[model samples]
Structures are given as C-alpha cells and as structure tokens.
Target: MDIQTLRLFTHLAKGLHFGRTSRACNISPSALTRTIQRLEAELGEQLFFRDNRSVSLTQAGEYFRAYAEDVLQRREQLQLQFASNRELKGSVSLYCSVTAAYSVLPDIFQRFRRGYPQVHLKLQTGDAAAALPRLQNRETDIVIAALPEKLPGRIIFLELTETPLVFIAPTDYPGTVCHSTNSEQEIDWLQTPFIMPDTGLSRRRVDQWFAEKKITPHIYAEVAGNEAIIAMVSLGCGIGVVPLLVLDKSPVRKQIKILACSPPLVPFSIAVCTIDKKIRSPQVQAFWNIATSIENAYKKGPTPHMKNGVSKN
Candidate 1:
C-alpha cells in the first residue's frame, strides 16, 4: 500500500525468509507477519506459501513482486525528477567483495562524500559472485565486480582495473600440493590437490582452463569466496586460483606463494556494474560519475607499478 510496505514485500520475495526480511527491514517478526496479513487481506489473495521449514512465493506473489519492483523504481525516478534543484539526497546501496571495499572504493567514497554530503551510501560486502545477481534483483544500486566474458544486456559496467588470476600455494607447507614444479607440463594435475571457486566468473574461467589443458583437476575443496580460498591455501589445504588484487589485500598474504604456470590464466577486468534503470537515479548517477572520473584519471595517469604481480597505484 505504501513505499515501505512494497519494499518489505519485495525484499521478502527475494530472500523468502521471514526472519531475515524482518531483521533487515527493521521490523519485529510479529509486525512483519501482521503487515503481510494486512496486505493479503487488502489484495484478496495469498502471496506466499509458508511452512515451518521453508517459504516460497505463490503465482500471485511472483506477479506482484514484479509490480512492486517497477513501482519502487518509478518512485525513485519521480523523486529525482521533482527534486532536480534540491540537494541530492537518498541512499544508494552498494555490493562488493571485502577486498574491493578496501582497495577500490576509498577514492570514490571520499569524492562522493565531499560532493554530496546528504546522500547515504549503504555498503554490503560478501562474495564477488553475488554482485550481479543482487544488482539484477534490485537489492543494490551499484556493485564493484569483475567484468564477465559476456555481460548481461540489462547491466552497464565501467572498467576500473585489471588483475591477473594466479595460482597460489602455501609457503610454509612443503607438501605434495606445494611441491616445486618448474612448468605446467611437469606437474601432475591429477595428483595435485586444488582449491577452486564454487561459482562465478573466476570459477568458469578456471573450468575452461582445465578443459583446454585436457586434465581433470584433483579438487581438494570448493569454496565460495576468493578470500576463503586464500585462507584455505594458506593452511596448506591446496593450491588455489584467485585474483592478484585479492591476494595482495589478504591478511595471510605472507603465508601464500604465487606459482608460475605455462599459460597464465586470463586476467580479470574489475569494474563497477549496475542495472540500466538504477543508473538513472540522481544519487546513483552521482556515484557513477565519481567512479567514471576516477577511471578517467587512472587512464590519464602513469601506469601503476606492479608489486608481486599486483598493480599498485
């Protein structure tokens, strides 16, 4: 019935968990239940099917979720249009990996804060793999992510930097996984224990690399975040592939060593990505412009020096 109500519904639709949605929306579980009940009563239809163990959207809920998202997006646009002359206000949610938050966003945040003090930046950090899906779901306005091989049509990305994907092994562990092999051909891929990403761009790239080499990897573990992979490798779990940027920023950097491969893994083009419509919001546009300016500055500036295969500006 109202913007807040619609927001709650849409967020719940995405997560499909009453407890998480209630906590995120800053409402008590009882209040959230009452709110949904009120909405269902008003609409004369059940929106979600809830049981003790699971929650799911009904057919009506799916249609209403789409409607709610459109309405919320349009409201943001309308607000932006009406307040053209006023100071830019409203929040822009951002999603990125923890490494990106530390390495990539500081300059952009500093500039944005100085220019638009009234605007709020809500940052959420997790696996880089979730960035695009969260953006598509309208959960976040902007994301710092690696540019995928084939970008989705609904999203726009601005390249910020490029980082090589490298293999890493434990420095202290002199196990079979960390054995010194002069070249890719010398190593026995079947016997080597390897840590790999469970999903996302890096995972696909690694998969392709293995396929081209015509070798089935001896996977030790499948982890979610690159940070986690670094941690596991540092513990002598297995050699893992991760972005050089992530490795450089990792706390256990000293515990890990980069391994040379015959054919190096393709580098990742890190970028800021957002849906086409969200970019049109005034606050979101301001953030994008700041990122754009930074990107342009980097282009015009001297090339960053390479430190242990990581670029340093």
Candidate 2:
C-alpha cells in the first residue's frame, strides 16, 4: 500500500468511525469506503468490522495498524535524512484542544514556519483528554497536553505553562446552585450539580480534591472535553471545573462566573508530550526544539498571571 493509503487506514483504525475519519482525511465517505475495501481486497483479509452503528478493527486490522504506522514513520525519517543538506521538508502531526490552538500555538507556529517553511504542520483539534492516547497510538507525532500525575515512562514531557483549575457556574442561572462563599464548609458540595470531566488530568485532580474534602460530588453530567463542560455550565445545566487557560480562551467567558473554593483545585501543568521513539525524528525534533525555547523564555521572563479568568502579562 502507498503512504497516503496507510496514513488513512491508521487514522481510521485509531478513531474507528467512518464519518470522522472521512471528514478529517478530507475525503468523501463513499470514496473512503472504497479505499478501505480496496485495501482489504488487496490483503485478502477483513481489516475492519463495519455495521450500521459502530466500526471496530478486526484481528488482521490490529496487526496491520502497527505495520502501517512503522512504514509511515520510516518514510518520514527517510525524507528527513535526504533533505538534511537542504531545508527540513517533512510533515509533523500535532494534536491539541481548540483552546490550545488559539492560545499556545500561534507564536510557536510563527517561529517554526520562519525557520522551516517547507515543513508542513498537520493539526487536529479535539478533546484535551485524548492527546496522550493519540500520541501513544502513533496517530500523531506530537501533542499539547497536561502533565499527568503518573507520567508514563515511554513519554517525555516539556512544560509549557500552568493554569489553576477553577469552579465555574452560569452567571444568570435561575437557581442558587453556586454562591460567593469563602469557606468550603459554607458551600453545599454534596448537593451541587457538578459537571465533571470524563477522563484526564483535570478529572484526576478534581476527584482528588473531592476526596480530600471527604465529600461525594453530586455529578450531574460527565463530559468529554473541558470546552463541552464550559458550554454545559453556560446553559445553566451545572457547575463545572476547568482550567483557567480554557476559560480564558472560551467565547462564552461572559456567560460564566468563577466560583470560590476554599482550598482551590490543583493547577494544571500544560506541556508538549511525545513518545520517546518519535523524539528521534528530525521533524519531531525540530518542533520539540521550538517548544523548548519557548519554555525557557517563559522561565526567564515575567510569566503572565490570571485574574478574573483573564491572563495579563
């Protein structure tokens, strides 16, 4: 199979959804189906189990996924090796939440492009929680993510910035689910309808905060992305806990108000994460170096501070 075909297959295998894969790959659904069918026919094996509701990788598909990823990665390496005498001319896949793309990526992208204009950057924005998993699965070369409490040994994290985790509620909600209480005892933690993260570093921090207070949170909804939680909270559905960075970048910032928690939730340590093996790639290394320079500049300069859900230098 060709590099482009293998890339499409690997992306489909990771997401396991036809519509999403087709949209992300910029291909018609019917065309994508035909491509997969051709691959299966060429291999003489069923790669994916497809039905009306869901799609899943078959046994053969799982095996081929590894092979496909290896081939794609090697192709990138070979391209970089040949272009060493000239300019860097390869693609780097990046995954991050939309908020990160807006807040964190602009400067880095500007600088990287100035240095290596030939390097193509493929960015996929989605739930922040999925960043590490996508990186580990080799669906992307690098990801912007929060530093997990227990970092995997195979992953390398370079700190970019930190933001406090804060509780937020709708400003014009009809009910009294939230109040401006200075003490934790004054707030009704057990009765409040909390919108929590489905999984990720923020979820773990929120759970730990609740456990420390010895209060079982009344979870009203479990959302996948922090942006979704913000949207839900804006609709007067329930209060949510999210990073200050996300809150700052949200379009509905005026609709939501940050609530006071006596002992505030732990701040998130945002970073650029990549697998150990991928770090050796020239394109990946170039991106990593730019991120590292930004991190060092932040350390040496006056860091921005958050106030009233806004960042000020």
Candidate 3:
C-alpha cells in the first residue's frame, strides 16, 4: 500500500478513534475510512473493528500493522542510509528523564561528540513515562528511561545504567539518617526536610516506601527535576533524598553527602530504549553501544545489586 495510507493507518492504530485519527491525518473521517478499506482490499484483510465509540485492531490488522510499520521504517532508513554513505551527518535525537539528563547522559553526549564530531545531537528531558510515546511516534531516535510499564510489540529495550537510588543530604547539615531500601526509621529523619520529585516511577517508589514506613518528613519542596533537587540540597535549603548518580564528584564531595544508610537504598534500573532494531538508525545503535560501554559513568559506589542501577564515579 502507499506510504500515506500506512502513515494514516499508524496514527489511526494509536488514536483508535476515527474522528481523532482523521483529525490527526488532516483528512475527513470518510476519507480515512476509504483509505483503510483500500488498504484492506490490497491486502485481502480488514485492519480494524469499529463499533462506534470503540475501536480494536483485528488480528489481521494487528499483523499487517506490524509489517506496515516496518515498511515505513525502512522507507525512512533508506534516506539515512544514503546520507551515511555520503557522510554520517544528521542529528541523533534522544529523550531522557531529568535524572539521566543530569547524571549519565551529559557524559554520554560528551563522549559521543568527541568521537562523532560531525554528527549533531539533540536531547530533551522529562519523566521517562512522558518520553516513551515520543519514541513510539518516531519523534526521537532513542530514549533513556526506567523502561515503560509494558513493551509494545514495536519497541526495544537495552539495559543501560542500573544505579542505586539513595537518600542524600547537604554534606554539612545532617540530623540523622538511616540506610535501608527495605525500611528505615522515620523518627531519624522526621524533622529533616524532604524533597519530592514531581513525577516518575522512582518518585512513586520513594513515596510508597516512605508511606509504608509511616514516616513523613517536612518536605522542603516538590520540584520538577533531580537537578533542582540537588541544587537545593547543595545550597543547604534542607536535606533532600536523590538518586546518587545525580550527584557528580565536585557536587557530591563538596556539596552533598551520603547520609548513613543502614539498609542501604533500593536501586532502580535505567535503560536505553527505542523502536525495535529493524527500525532504529545506525547512529542510534552507535550511541546505544557507547552508552552501555561507559558503565562507570554514574556510579555512587560498587555493589552486586547496584551494578545495573547505581553508578559510582
């Protein structure tokens, strides 16, 4: 089928609403329906089941959509492949959560630039949850996140940095702190100020872990990014708990300290993810390879459980 039909179909599959998909495709609802019909005729199979207010992919549609997407991917790659032949000069865009943005990604991008000086790079940061859909839409070449809740048939995941999530405070201003991912004494840190991240699974994990322990510290602030949290803590606004990776050496040694943790903290795995290999461009693959190789980028220290999630400099 035509690329336009496949493009329209891809958006339809995601929106799953005729009016919504039609609006997105910039075509009338009837025309969208006709395109789907034409695609079905060409393939001898229907692609969707529509029953006003609800839409689901037929088994045939599901299978064809997979192939259709591959076709679309190849069509895009063709141009990139040609460009690579000429010279691998184009932007490789990545979407990252703020944690990765501050922690591992800066170093990764630096090294990437050192090696691939001719290649341009673009990066945007947000909660991983917010960034994965952009990956699905092909808005970014790859993404660094905590991994999505579920992997759709169309994407791929590469384990990157598994860094320990830790409780930290300004180097000089500690009241009392405990170290345990499983559980900690609330009384120890009750009066200390807590900084909550605005969003992310790790934020949820920290929140739940505290709630279960029946400990509610006085929150210094609720901030949008890990960088801001660290900055606040470094300024001694209050003690803020953060992923250890977010604290680089100059900042960590001079500004923040790892408060004594009895149980140590739970760790979270960070990974590089993108559309499946068949769809990912070479530049994406090259960057992904380099990232995995630089495993020591953001470690807080060394430990068996922390290897994948925690980075120690």
Candidate 4:
C-alpha cells in the first residue's frame, strides 16, 4: 500500500532474491520481508512465492507488480511536479546483450549525461532471455536486445534496426568466401567449423537455417561473448555467426573479414526494451528520447555484440 513498500516489491520481483534486493535498497533482509508481508496482507493476496533459497512472483504477484508500478510512478510524478526542477535527477538501470552495451550505449549515455548530469545510469549485460524477467520485475528501467519478435506482459518493445546475420573469418585465412558482403556459390558448411552464441535465441536461428540445408555446423567450439568469437576466428578457431554491427570498428576489426552470403541468414532486430514507458519519470522520458535517435552517432553501443558478455577470457 505504501510507496516505499511498492518500490521494495518491485526490486524484489526483479532480483527474486531477498538478500540481493535488501542490499540494493540498503535495508536489512528482515525489514524487506516485513514490508512485502505488510503489503501482501493489506492486498489480501500473496505477491511472491518464497522457497528456501529463492523467490519468484506468483500469478497474484505478477498482477500486483503492474499496479504497484503504476502507484509508485504516479507518486514520483507528483513529487517531481511540486519540487523546483534543479535539473533532472534519479537513476535509470538498463540490461542488454554485450554487443549493445559496447556498440550502442556510449552516445546515448553521453547525451543523457550532458542533459541531466544528476541522473545515474547503471548498465548490466546478459543474454536476451535473462533480461526480460528483469524488466518485468522492474530491476532495470531499460533493456537492449536482439530478438525476432515481441516481449511478454506489459513490456514495451522499441525497434532500432534490423541487423543482418553475417559470417566472419580471419583476414589472413584462405577460405576466400568471407571477404565480401555477397556470394555467388553455395557456402560449404561441411568444411568450415562454426563459432556460435550459446544462448537459445542465436542457437534457434542458426539451427533452423542449417536444418533447411540438411547441413550440421562443424562447430570447433561453443564460445560465449561476441568479442571472443571474433578473437577466436582471428586465431583460426572457427568462423563466427554474428550481427554486422559487431564488425564495425570492433576491437579486432582489421583482423577479420565479413563472409559472403546468398540471401543472408535470419536478420535479428535491435531494440530498446522497457517496462511500460508511461510510468517512467520525466528524466527517464528525456533519456528515452535521446536513445530513440537512430542516427549513426548513437547507433554504436557499449558492448557491441558479444553473445552474452562482450568477450571471453
């Protein structure tokens, strides 16, 4: 019922760990539990499913989550309106794949920082599947991911660009198939070893494409992170399947070449994922506007396409 309790629940839902949420809010674990318990008791419903080691939102918890955000957001807006705006302030947390963190986040952060220096930006990187539940739970305010379709629940999807899936091989390597953006002959899947993202989204797309040709990838290694895939290809581990953006001024840019393709593999979309935007504060709104600018200036992000994190060691 209280705003502080609602905010506590929101963070708890995102972390799904009472201890972590308590740490994040700078409160004790017992206090965190009591706050949620009070709120749940007032609502006459359970908000979380607490197991011995972990927690998850129940069906009723999920419903409470939406209304809780609404309440907290409205309360914040009222406070903002009453205060003499001394410059926009507050925090915006974001979760994204490694590529987006590298290639996509810099300018957005730069512009956001210049406009409202008081606003805090907290960035975290994870795979596509891991980010969604965090957004749903309000752990982070924004998410950047490469996905084929829509998000679940009240999350809002903001499309940035449709990126092509391209193959990359080392420059000194002699395959002679990857130097150009186009190809005339069928790529020999049998001869080449593949380096692929370990996550489900990339695996599914690659699997479906290979399934049609009745060709199984000769994977030399299954690596995590886009930079490592590119680095491994440089050391001649295997050719990698990654978004084209990763190749643009990448760390080992000169060392790799983009492979030729017939029709190209599936094009994954780059988008800014968010909790319902309307509930976002004015400072958050301002940053969202800055992020929506699709110009090449803001196009490159923080991690720039390493599947999970940007690199593997």
* Top of the candidates by lDDT: 1
Q: Which candidate, 3 or 4, would have the higher lDDT against the true structure? A: 4
Candidate 4 at 293: error in angstroms? 5.0
Clashes of each: 0, 0, 17, 19
* C-alpha positional error of residue 19 in candidate 1 after TM-score superposition, expressed in Å: 6.6
The candidate that achieves the highest TM-score relative to the unseen native structure? 1
Expressed as tens digits, the lDDT of each residue in 49-146 for candidate 1 is 99999999999999999999999988987898876979888788899999999888988899999999999999999999988877766678898888
Cα lDDT tens digits, model 4, 10-108, are 888767889868865779999888898888888899988888977889999999889887787788778678534566677777888777777777777
Off by over 4 Å in 2: 10-24, 28-30, 44-70, 170-175, 178-185, 231-237, 250-257, 295-313
Please write out the lDDT profile of model 3 over residues 88-156, one tens digit for every residue: 666688888666776667777878888788788887776555666666655567887665345555666
Which of the two, 1 or 3, has more lDDT? 1
lDDT of 3: 0.68
Give the alpha-carbon lDDT of every model.
0.84, 0.82, 0.68, 0.71
Report the C-alpha lDDT of model 2 over 149-218, residue by residue, as the tens digit: 6776578777777788898999889473843267543667666789989998888888898889898988
- Higher-TM-score candidate among 2 and 4? 2
- Candidate 2: give the clashing pairs: none
